[model samples]
Target chain A: MGELRRDPVRNRWVVIDPERPDREAALKVEAQPPPPLSGPCPLCPGNEAMTPPEIIAFGESSRQRNQTDWSVRVTPDLQPLCRIEGDFDRRPEGPFDVMNALGAHEIVIESPQHLLTWAEFPEQQLERVLRTYRMRSLDLRLDGRFRSLIVVKNNADAAGILRHPHSHVLALPFIPYGIEEELRGCREFYARKERCAFCDIILHERVSRVRRVVETDFFVVLAPFASRFPFETWLLPLRHASDFGKIGEKELVDLASLVKRTMQMVGKVLGNPSCTIVLHSTPFDEPHTHDYHWHLEIIPKTAPVAAFGWGARLFVNPIPPEEAAALMAQQM
Target chain B: MGELRRDPVRNRWVVIDPERPDREAALKVEAQPPPPLSGPCPLCPGNEAMTPPEIIAFGESSRQRNQTDWSVRVTPDLQPLCRIEGDFDRRPEGPFDVMNALGAHEIVIESPQHLLTWAEFPEQQLERVLRTYRMRSLDLRLDGRFRSLIVVKNNADAAGILRHPHSHVLALPFIPYGIEEELRGCREFYARKERCAFCDIILHERVSRVRRVVETDFFVVLAPFASRFPFETWLLPLRHASDFGKIGEKELVDLASLVKRTMQMVGKVLGNPSCTIVLHSTPFDEPHTHDYHWHLEIIPKTAPVAAFGWGARLFVNPIPPEEAAALMAQQM
Candidate 1:
């Protein structure tokens, strides 16, 4: 089993899972000319055997488990970050904290066809992908050990593990520092102003219009005021909500449309830049802080920033959110 | 003037400076095949006029200021992350915090020869580079606008802006969340153990010897137990200290040698991987936390992990630190 180790100097944990797939092997695909984009992939319909058996799938035609006809499929990651079967035993090893790397990591294969990304997906297929995300998020919460889940998609341009279009459904056994700090930021703002910080942001961006890329009935896609990367964006729900699993069907439909359209708009501007899109929500076991709002952060990966970011935690973004928003909005 | 904005959802700040080379223009050099190493480099001694005028330099036989005989040089970054000419004004903008992107940023040119990396530098040259780092750090503190200073070097392999071996001296107007958390982690551990957390880590690792890469009278080069990346290393001073600007002359020389040797050993194993090396210390104007120890975090930038990390704050390192330590240890 892989181990979860706590950082000695910071409130952080890393999943050290050499057995899952060594970094060398995990990234070996990149060494070769990517085998052509729409070629045989492990997540493709016929290659069901390559990945773990399907946990769920969404399509109008009812297909049996592990069938080829499904539009979107969910399967256990072949190289999971943390294994599902383990005792979440945490103990102190001298001065460091160590634990069993226990969690559920599943891949939500978005489309059977590798050619279509979120930007190119049919509206119905995009809705199904979003619906499947929520379904798996709720399903993973049933696991007693997990506390938080993030639905994450690293674009093909980002050199993700697979060329196939998919998002990872990672149910972590503990809340991450990012989640903790976000919650604290919200609670602190609410304690002072008696209002949700995200809600206030929606209000401010709506008035300013400079950072607002698209404002729909249910969702507003805005470039964050303090964007860490060029063309970074956020999909925020106008209606106050902390849990993604609790989103209404009508709202989900609007969110799906807005998300697809926003990505397309951003694509037109950046020529389809690689992006890491993470949908963050409240932890499963904790009592929900009303001020905490679910959000999707779309960070476009510009080259060499990561190397710079590692050394200095202070982010230095070149393109201001206002400029990024204006550039993206012009695509509309 | 550039602007600094606080993240709406996290206790984080970003310096958004479009004027200091927008991301597109900042990366234009990458679009073309890089100029041949040691070919018309700006940081070269003869090209002193190409960069901001020399702030300092070191060599046994010193030439006049901005002359061509220096082993190492210091100059203001032609495109600094934050400018030194701004008033550090901070205010809340609705729900978000806004501030002037005010600070001093300088480049520590480690070698005049572009082809000479730290692993290839002469022993004396390496010592001069380290000495230059300490000198610039103490000099930057004379400014009243900055609260924290980080002496950081991103290796040439890391796709740093300049091919010349250089370190960035970034003095921030506020203590970063990373510095804050590190101080807190040390304080909490001290509250219980009444011993410095880093000291205990040193004691524990020395007893184990598995993660120790090298140890000298003044310092220990270690692969941290919870390394966020493969072969992530740290250089810690054995003697108790919480500030990098306060290191003595002999200790600095010893640190330089150990740093050089450790990198060479790591180079032999990883085939010269790109790395971001950051020297973290106590924040200026803050009382030193007794349990906090100054250290250097050397993160080797493995490809594509940054993409995955952007989505999942919980790091998944395929290589365990123990195995990583053993790999580097074998090279020695």
Candidate 2:
């Protein structure tokens, strides 16, 4: 089991998972050329036995759990950073605070084929994948120990050796610092103007139109005015919603389309650079927060984050949001 | 010129420096092997004309500025992200805050001999480099527009094309979020215990000794309890100090040795991996804070910062600090 340790000075928690795969070993594996697409991928349909028992699967009714017919499958991570069976066991160690790593880590396998990414999946298959994300999020929230859940995809080379099309759904015991900061900002904004900050952003972007990349019927993809990375974008619903789990079936279909289209555009623009797509929603334990707005942040890893960024929480993005938006819009 | 933009949701500022060299161009330069030690290195002794005029130099008093006899030199960055001569035209665009990027960016050339690193420098030369850092920091603080100063070094391959043995001294108009978080946490800790959090950490580490890598007469280097990266170490003075610029001459010499020793140990253990070393001190504008203690954080870039870290502000460090400390100590 791993443990969560707090930095006394910064008061930030980090998961120290000794059980996680060795970094050097992972790097060595990544250094080799990726296996062939039709190679024995564990996430492929016939290799269901290579993975742990499926927690949930979406496919034909005649097929059994972890069967070939499944289009999407959710399973516990083989080497989870946080285990589901531990008590938090929070305690003090001198000046520092620590606790048992008590949460859930699951993988949402998006395709039955050896496809490399979700963007390459068909519309119907991608819709099932998005629906699976919502279903798993709602299911994980039922666990009282979990306070927050994040759906994140580490696609292509950036994800290391795990090349199959999948996203990770992490149930954390506490709201992460990033989300907490956003929530606090949103609450403050709401207290002052009685409006969600994200909602205000949507309205402002709609009027400005300079940073808007694409506007769909239900979602809008835009380059954030203060994007930390070049070509960084956000996908948000036009209608305000706080929890991803509460998204309607119709909204899920729209979200799937928007996500796929946005990713395709990103790939086209950046020559298929490795990226991280993360869904930010209200914490599972805090469903009643009206100020919070759910959204997806797509960050293309085009450059290395150097000292200036790592040391000072300050980023130097060469590309302006307006220019990035224009370039992305041109791709369409 | 660059502009600073603030993220409305997370309330973090980023410098959008369009004038800075493109990352791809820099990557191309870095892809080539490092220039030979005797090559026409701009930072080397005879090639002083190749770089900007020297702001300060430490060598034979008979030598003229930008001449060959300097052991240590300070010069303005050829391409600075922030310019020194500008008013911070702070304004609001909708809900977002924007300001002119106004600051001083200088490079502290560690040696005239094209030796690639400070670790290989003699103690006396390294001491001069440390003193130069203090002198430049004190000089920059005299400007009232500057609020914070960060002395950072990006060593080895991952730091980018600038392979010369040097450190960056940036004087910023705003205190970065990373420092602000530490200050806030420190203030909160002092409010409750009426003691500096860093002081408590030193005392605790002294007693525990599990995460202590090296302890000297004036400084102690230890792996942080919640280190975000593997083999991350922090060097702090034994006594509480709020400013790096205020270090005594003897303490500067001691810091120089400790820093070199720690870096050497890190290299021996990690096989000369790329790394970043950053100094965190009190903000220049408000210098009377008792809670904030100055320290140097050395982060060895052992692995890629993947999506989970970027999205959640949560880190999954595979190596625990205790284990990392032990490994580093063995190398020493």
Candidate 3:
């Protein structure tokens, strides 16, 4: 396993994975439909031996693991960002901090079939996907070494190298910088207002409804007020919950329907642009139950990353959130 | 004009430029060599009328404004991320905070000719470029509405839509989040150790010299200890300086030479990869004089922005800085 290094003078961590494959492989994914796979499609049902042995799979009650009959499956990432084993050994390298890249990286195959986009994923299938996500989150968090975990889905021609619809579960030894910022901000806001910052935003957005894109029984999907990208949509649960592992099945079903519809709208209005779906839950070990609210963000990759704001980490969106919401309404 | 919006629960700010031009044009830059200039090259000598009126230029003693005789020039961005006018208005849109995109965005034409890359810039011409950055920075600071400014240069074939060798000057009404974080880190370190964080980094780096790529009279260019990307280089001033505008004429000459040589190495080793050159100067009107040190960071566009870290604000580097340094040394 490689190691993680802390920026000497900044609050950022970087994982130096010398074993990363020629990342150029992902870029070629679009051009090579089968993704330059060795034999048959590794993700497809019959190619069970192709990928690392399945970690978990949901299929017929009569069937065994790694079967073609499976609906959803999870496996160790062939190109893991962080390895599965290590003592999160942190030592000082001169004046800088360094630690082993200890945690888990797994692939959540949303479907065993090719050509199925999230927009086309059935509500039942998406619900299964969410369950798989929660299962992996819970399982990974059980490891005392991991501090944070995320379920990230990349769906775009540019970024979606794998034609087979899927997501990735990344468990890290520490909470990421952005999450730490939000945790700090929410903690301070709660200290002052005695309410969760996300709950306040949900209430405000519901009342204003300017950037609201969709709302279900248990979730409210909205274009965030300060969207970093055009058509940037977010899904926040109506209830105040910090941990994703605590999500109930009924809530997951509601979320799955809302996600399916939201993705369909995104595809219809935005021509199915490349986008990222990120699940931000409370860190594994943190129990700031009332101060933080878990949420999901869907960011359309509408702009290049090499813009002027790259250095500053500020984003420049070509369109405002209200207008984006209106665009979604038009398509709806 | 566009406006800046703060993320409701986080510290990040984003610009919503409704009038932004076709950003995809930059993607097409590599395909269009002269970059599809409508008429004559805008930055070239005689066609200076094509761009927004020139702000400053340096050339022959007898030359007039916006003349073909200039060696280097500066102009307001034709399509700025933030407008040059407007009061720095801050208001609440429901539960979120926002302000007008009040700032100056100028283009610094590094060379008169379109074909000259920074690596090919003559030392004298590059010095003129640095002088132009300082002049505009100082001029923009006088506005009092601006809080921080960065001199940014994008020279990748993928991002360099304007074929002319140039950089940008962005002055914002607030310090960007990255700069703010650095300032906070530096201040906290100073409080604890009574030493400038960057000064200690410079000392540690010089003593180890493991990641040092080049050193000159006034600058040491090194692969930062925890580089976010492979070959992500930082050029730190040898002297403890907190403000970029305070750089003297002699130091400017040394910096120019170092910059030129470093760019040459980056070009040779990285195959003229697209990269961002950012100057992190002290924010205007703030004087944490002893705690901070201004520096420049050069990040290679080796990875896409839509990576998983896009959500976490963490970074995953494929290679370690030591190996990256070795690669640089091999080329040198």
Could you report the DockQ of all the candidates, in the order they appear? Answer: 0.17, 0.19, 0.20
Residue-level error in angstroms, candidate 3, position B124: 0.1
Docking class of 1: incorrect
RMSD of each: 9.9, 9.6, 9.2
Q: Is candidate 2 or candidate 3 better by lDDT?
A: 2
Q: For model 2 chain B, give the 10-residue run with minimal summed lDDT.
A: B22-31
Q: Tell me the deviation in Å of residue B272 in model 2.
A: 1.5
Top candidate (lDDT) = 2
Model 2 lDDT, residue B64, Cα: 94
Backbone steric clashes in candidate 3, count: 1
Which rank order by lDDT, best down to worst?
A: 2, 3, 1
Q: Evaluate residue B17 in candidate 1 and report its C-alpha lDDT on the 0 to 100 scale.
A: 28
Q: In terms of DockQ, which candidate is stronger, 1 or 2? A: 2
Q: Relative to the true interface, what fraction of contacts does candidate 1 keep?
A: 0.21
What's each prediction's TM-score?
0.87, 0.88, 0.88
Query: Across the candidates, what are chain A's individual TM-scores?
Result: 0.86, 0.87, 0.87
lDDT of 1 at B161: 46
